[model samples]
Structures are given as C-alpha cells and as structure tokens.
Target: MGVTLLTGASTGIGRSLARRLAARGEAMALVARRGELLDSLVIEIEQAGGQALALPCDVTDRDALARALASAEAELGPVTRLVANAGGGEPTFVDGFDSAAFEAVIQLNLIGVANSVAAVLPGMLARGDGHLVATGSLAGRRGLPSAAAYSAAKGGLANLMDSLRIDLRGRGVAVTLLMPGFVRKHEPKPGRGKTGRRRSKPFRVDLEYATARMEKAILARRRQLVFPLSLAVAIGLTRLLPFGLDARLLAGRGRRRPAAAQPPRTRL
Candidate 1:
C-alpha cells in the first residue's frame, strides 16, 4: 500500500513496527491470523492520518497472501515495502518437543516468509522500486537447545533471503534481513524484562531501540542487518566452533559454570 505491507501484526515487534510506521505517516497493509487485532491497528493508524488496509490472512497460505496483496493494491496504492514477519516460537524443548509445533514453525516462519515475498515481488519488480524485509532473530545464526525448529526456520529464512537479495539486487528491489536480539514486549510476560546487574534473565530488548534499528535499516535499505554486537559475534563464533563443543555449549551440557546459568536470550 504505497509503502509498506506488514505480516504478523497481531502483537510483539510487528505491532510496534506497524504503530511506528503509521506515526511516520506511511501507508500500510497489515496481515495476521487475528482480523480483530488488525482492525484495531487500522483504526489507530487511520485516526492518526495514515492510510492502511487490514487484510487478514495466514502468511503460510501462498495463494491467500497473493490475494491479500492484490486487495491492498486496490485499497491503497502500489506496495512499496513489505515486512515478512509472520513467525512462531515453537518446539520449545529438547526431547520434550511437540512434533506439530516444530512443523508449524517451519511452515509459518520459513514458507510463510516465502509466500509474502512471492506475493509482492512481481509488482515491485515491475515498478522497479520496493524494499522487502524479514524479521529474523540472532538465534538464526545458532541452534539453541530448546528452540531447534525456530532456529532452523529463521536460519532458513536468512539463507533464502541471501539468494533473493542477489537475484533482485539490480532489479531495483531491495532486501533486508533484520536480526533482532530479543526485543521485549509490553505483554508476553516472559519478555517484559527487568533491569540491572541481574540484567533481566529473560530476553531483554526495548521497543524504542528495536524501532530505531529497523528505521535505520529500512531507510538505508541495508542487507543482513544484525544487532546487539555481542550477541551477533557470539552467534557468528558458534559456526566456527567444533561440533562437539558447540553441541555441548548449546545443550547446556557440562561446562564449568555460572556465567551461563541465565542462558543466552536466544528466544524468538
């Protein structure tokens, strides 16, 4: 819709991004499983003098995503930007994982992103101007003991976008992979966050900080943006570690120590 299309707008970072973009007066199309939530966001955006269309659709549905884009075009204008953010935090365990949740994560986090990209690319290519962004996580660069599926999906998305970036580089389309380090949400208590020395055992990130990061990347049209340098470096190192040591570290196996008692905040 003129500038942006957002998926996974029901809550968390997606919702925050939507609000921020609206405040900046960008036209948008919001998608999520909950039409009710999109409705509420649409009301807020419109009242703030921004144009938006709420196209409730599951990001995993290839055809549905394409149809929603058409609707967004008809209602607003050309789609100039897209946030492929529909995702799931799944398989939240080691051996105790749920097969269904694991599968669903791949479908939503990986294939869903693919669907969103496919839906918008044709028009963007024709116009020769557009930006495609996908919300990835630091976890994408490493496998956490419990978040196997999530890590896999996000990692897959990063790889997928890498190739897409190459294919579209000279086509006048831009691709950005935003890797955030656990941005906390107002709700979702597990991520609300605390402060100081204990340093919020949970995944700690402030909304403003994340929004600023996204704003810069979106404006500059950068590629493969990672955040919180410390976490970024850690994940990068994980790839170079010997498999045994890496496995032990990630699984929380015997390693001397309290330093990691709180564990790394690698959650989605």
Candidate 2:
C-alpha cells in the first residue's frame, strides 16, 4: 500500500480508522490539532510495528495544512491516499444564529476538505495514482432541526467530493465519500446518571464495524458508501416526505442541550 495521510487523526472516527489502517501496515501520516494525542497515537502504532508520522496542525489553516502535507510526504513518501476527515460542529439554532460559529464550522468542514485536496491533488495528478476519501454525514442528506450549519457544511462537502470524482474520472485518482449514521466513541457506562444512560442513537454502529466497512469502500474505490444500511434507506425515504410534515416530525427533536455549550471539539 502507498503512503496514506489522514486529517482529524486525534480522536473518534479518525483515530479508529488510523488504527485499522495501521494494523494493515500502511505507511501513515496522521494530522490533527492535538499534538499530544497524535504523539501518543504514533507511539501506539509504532509499538505495534506500523509506520506512522504525527503532524499536529489545524486543518482550518490552509498554509499549515499544506506544510503538514509536505512534512508527511517528506517523511513517509508521497501521499497516495488522502483522507479529508477533520470536522466538527455544534447545534446552530435559527432563533439564536451565531454567524461566527457557523462560519467556523464551514471553514473546518468544507474549506478544510478543499484545502487538503488542493495540497495533494497536483502531486497525485502528476503521478496519476491516488485516492481521495472524505467523511461526510447522513445529516447531509437533508437539513436538520438544530444543526443548520453542520448540515450545510456536510452537504457542501458531499457535493464537492462528487464534483471531484467526476473531474478526476479515468485519471487514476479515485474518490470515495463515507456517509455514516450515529457512531459512538465508546459504550455508555451503566447507572451513572440520566446523561450516562445509553441514549438511543439512530442506527448506531460500533466504531470497529464502521471503520471496517469504510476500509472496504476505500479499497474498492466506491463513489459513495452509506451505513448502516437501515439508516441510509431511512434517510433516502425521507426525501419523499412532504416538507411541512417532515419539519413537524423533526421539530424539537434536535434541540441543543445546554451542556453541549462547550465549543465544538475539533476532531474527525
């Protein structure tokens, strides 16, 4: 396998995917803002006999991201696979719209992905062999009740990947978009509190399963991969619903919890 560079490698899905890829002995360049986490991950991968380099940088900064990509290429070889996975967003309520917050999300989710692609596309085009993959969300299929900014960002990312795929067709660079439903970081602890109680996450899939499926899609160079199959079907069917009824059914369901007040954590 060729060198693979992934953003948002510090935590969550990004971290899980890195582990899976590392286990397969792929040369890796892991990028994220959290230096400590990335360092620890590098140690873990190296200890496990995988080759990896940790490059800590914020994806929102195009210059920094470019530098990170350069460092990765210098250390691990040209990045043959680029995963634009750095993204996060909190609730955006229409009643209290925060332009700055919305802009931040767009920068991170949409523009960040573009930056990653721009940093590596020229080299990939020159070599005529590479893969570009991104982590989109099931929420991108439609506008959500309280996550307007997030939904818009993810939707734009999906469209961006689609366009890239079309433009790069038959050029030897493949693109894949992963649209996943709820995926938990870990199992909830029992009897801690109401908050600790396992809330029902729609069609939630474990991290391992999600990463495994994503790996298969990447390897197959699939255009789009949505999961779990049940949620994908549900989201597709929602498109047939009348707007007014759909709004009513989804209203109040996505209310932002006050405790979610912490600025969105920057991760994949």
| lDDT of all predictions | 0.80, 0.85
Clashing pairs in 1: none
Model 1 accuracy (lDDT, Cα): 0.80
Predicted model with the maximum lDDT: 2
For each candidate in turn, the TM-score is: 0.86, 0.93
Task: Rate residue 94 of model 2 by lDDT.
Answer: 74
Tell me, by TM-score, which candidate is best: 2
Per-residue lDDT, model 1, residue 154, is 91
Model 1, residue 225: C-alpha shift (Å): 1.7
* TM-score of model 2 vs. true structure: 0.93
Candidate 1, residue 259: the lDDT equals 46
* Candidate 1 stretches greater than 4 Å from native: 96-98, 187-203, 253-266
